[model samples]
Target: MSPSAVVNKRAVVVEPETTGHKNVKTKSVLLHRHIHYEPSTVVAAKGNYVELNSGQKILDATGGAAVSCLGHGNQRVKEAINRQLDQVAYCASLFFGSSAGEALAKELVDGTNGQMARAYIVCSGSEAMEATMKLARQYFLECAPAQPERVNFIARKESYHGTTLGGLSMSGHVGRRALFEPMLLGNVSRVSACNAYRGMKEGESTKEYVARLAQELDDEFVRLGPQTVCAFVAEPVVGAALGCVPAVPGYFQAMKAVCDKYGALLVFDEVMSGMGRSGTLHAWEQEGVVPDIETIGKGLGGGYAAVAGLLIGHRVIHVLDKGTGAFSHGHTYQGHPVACAAALEVQRIVREEGLVENARRMGEVLEKQLKERLSSHPNVGDIRGRGLFWGIELVRDKATKEPFDPKDGIAMALHEKGLEPKHSISLYPGTGTVDGKSGDHIMLAPAYNTTEADITLIVDRTTAAIEDFFAQRSYH
Candidate 1:
């Protein structure tokens, strides 16, 4: 029953099999080719690693797409879930409120300088984003005395929000949105992202670049007649699509100013960059700007539970509370008691154990190690990121900064090579960093509790994998 006793117990580490790959031949019951044709069958996981059925222990460098922030098998989160289940596992938010849900919402809202006074819990980041979009729309309707024509949303190109229809409409990732283009809503418009690596001009000053972007945003609003734009959605730190690209100084302020001038709500998609992944509890905090709405997931539950939420700022909440007295969205499993309890405990542990500070400390180490290891490599283009969230952009030529052809599948190859037995690392791979087609990059977001040894292991294994992959290509 004691927390110290639980900490003393060793976690069960699943080992890979020495036998030949049998799972590969076995037809999977689930739809397997959703992302890739052949995916690794993870037998088990603990701490900051996952064991594949192939008998390889992979250092989860990307935290399973940057989801597992607290790592695996945290006893406290597990205990919280058990306790919540005993009390109440599920309660409809419409009928009655659950303690676990109420506490989790309070913790999230209170942690963020009270910028967010209302929290809407959901099962995934995509769901949270959908709710955010709906909330933004509803807020506009409530505030506008007359039925306002502000139904349009402005989102940056190459940015990803979620997979659902509404979220997809707000997203501009070409590849992910291509198939769903016909079905996507028509209320969304695209703008350029603040990706300094790719978008910044070669000789442009940072201030000039930010100003130019601000002008572009203003121009877009003008083109759409400012009042037609309801919300401008963006990720404070561009994740997956651009590979951990943070906006340059004055970028967010400029964007926020534009939104404010046009009377459009500012929404931050912090699903991948929030909950201490970006050194700050909220990614927007680092930019010195606050958003009307913010969506957080992944690290919110620290991978101990499936939970995501949309944090509504006081301004937006006030409008809704005064008008409709309720949000126009609902999910069957919204604020599931067990998930809330697990996430609440995970967040508490993150705060109590000083993991956020640890993330900031280790982030410096990670940056140093990465720069030392790969900065001068011929194929390595640019290394950029902040806090513990980092990305290494790959190019065919460092001088020209030309990206490898998408046909080469360079990012996928690097990911596969990292997962090989000789290397055994789990990396997050991304493509289309350059013009949404030519560039490739890998993201590294190791667990916050990782030690220096873990950092060294990650760098070593990553270096070896890239070297081996290039070496084989040279031979070929």
Candidate 2:
């Protein structure tokens, strides 16, 4: 832990990973206005596939950035949505109650063994994250007679929450936070992620690595004056930022102990990893530890609706009910009936049809296929993930562990190439795996209902695309 030791550790650099395709069609719309153009238009979607305006059917390998968990089209979810539309599309949660919303909340709570007492639904993950922050603050104000000064949060570096101001404040993704750094709130601190593939030391065992991370968390709490630290926030399985990296064994337990010692809340941002993405109803269940507040989205509605929610633990609920008599926050669309209906049906399908178990089964097949096909590839650095979520970390040199230059756009090239008519596959591309500036990786979060044949197709297409990409690179 010496300064020299830290200095000796090479820092990862993240750079742009894009294809220099000049002739691609451009859009006149503002879009994510700040970012550049060349957008592809989707004409339609069905089951785990999407058809482009060009009439090509591309396999959705990453589930539209891991949002389409139940696949592109699900009749059950569609029928539920249509049924809710027939009943009521939107109902004001402020004064009125909707059966869809009530039923969904009850379902969520029941699924979690009633560990979650109350639910607050929102339109997107960012809203849920923002609500979580405010709720955590309110919990502190209402509970603990000491009038604690704990207003700070401790989150891991390279983590993402959302795009809203509060969510941005809690997020530690360097690229996402860079431009908005000046406007972000100043109540958050960061620690290293439990990224064993990159963060673990050469000789360290997984147990030792987890212990070290736990000690680091303890030290961070002490440095920040534990009494002033309100919550420790992290993604149970890191999503976009690190390519679906799960924590090492015992890591969560150690961190939970530290949080308990400091009387700080643990917030799990399961926006991408929850709702059976990691083979469990809740990712925390896999860790054998529960968070004081849990944010869930993405797979919740399975892309059938825009919905996200915060599952408030009993302790936080008790504190809020006692002090404020209500949560001191509200959004116009807090609990949209249609969204809840969609999510309810999605959850029901997952449980009734047994998609969680399917995710577990296919996830093993995926891991085996990936390792067998790409583990020894010179540029394939590390392959890691849980359940249906997985990432392939790409490096330039296998022995030296050097990453391809960001200027090379290796990951993006792979993605663009995969979209070619011959390849007919779509991949989620990522950069900055080495830090916030220099590495490349491709993430895969296939649909939970994916069949064995579908898995084989994906592996075949992905491997073929990768091989062709490398071949072209060698020629270049």
Compared with the true structure, what per-residue lDDT tens digits does model 2 show for residues 136-217? 8888888859445878999988888888888888877776677679999998989999899889999999999998999999
Tens digits of per-residue lDDT, candidate 1, 93-201, equal 8898899998999999988977778888899999998888777778878994833677899999878898789888888777666656899999899889998878888
Give the TM-score of each candidate: 0.93, 0.93
In candidate 2 the C-alpha lDDT for residue 363 amounts to 95
Candidate 2: which pairs clash? 12-434, 13-437, 13-438, 14-437, 14-438, 15-437, 150-228
Evaluate residue 4 in candidate 2 and report its C-alpha lDDT on the 0 to 100 scale: 4
Q: All models: lDDT?
A: 0.82, 0.83
Q: Model 1 misses residue 476 by how many Å? A: 13
